[model samples]
Target: MTTYSEEMEKLGQVTIFDLLPPSPSNAFSIGDSVRVVITVESDSESYHYLEAYHPIVLKKRGEIIEIQGNQQYLVNFAGELHVMKEHEISF
Candidate 1:
């Protein structure tokens, strides 16, 4: 099986590896505009690809968490709140 560490290593290495946790703050915030970027570790058919998929952060958490921790944010998508990752958004 692909280990969780292995998966995180691939997912975290793409810039976020250096920015997570106490060293630096997350790149986004509530009411901030963000676009979904194509990533190697992401599914190509994700909702982020749609032109109208742009979203605004509704809530944010885990700024002081570790790099590999479950830091996440809530975004306004299709009138619903969805949890999103730091890498899943682009400023």
Candidate 2:
């Protein structure tokens, strides 16, 4: 069976990991614009192609943020960053 780390690695590889950090507050939601282009760690070489099937869109403007260690900083807007779960982002 795939371990949680394995799943998380796959999630990272996809470049669309979850915001299950301290809490959902660290995560962005619908209507919020994307904060950054996070990278998922997958064995696939063509990550972009994989991403194409699952496009990450900014749901809100202030939903997504960058939390490192203990610092929480909101990501600057670059167009519309509507981020959601893999199922939601993916086609």
Clash counts for all predictions? 0, 22
Candidate 2 per-residue C-alpha lDDT over 1-91 given as tens digits, one digit per residue, 9 for 90 to 100: 9988789787764423354444444333333443333345542433454356434332223344443333244333444333234222221
Evaluated at residue 18, the lDDT of candidate 1 is 60
Strongest candidate by TM-score: 1
lDDT tens readout by residue for model 1, 63-89: 212233344666555455556677766
> So what's the TM-score on candidate 1?
0.40
Q: Which lDDT values do the candidates have, in the order given? A: 0.52, 0.40
Alpha-carbon RMSD, candidate 2:
14.7
Model 2 global lDDT (CA atoms, 0 to 1): 0.40
Which structure among the candidates has the greatest lDDT?
1
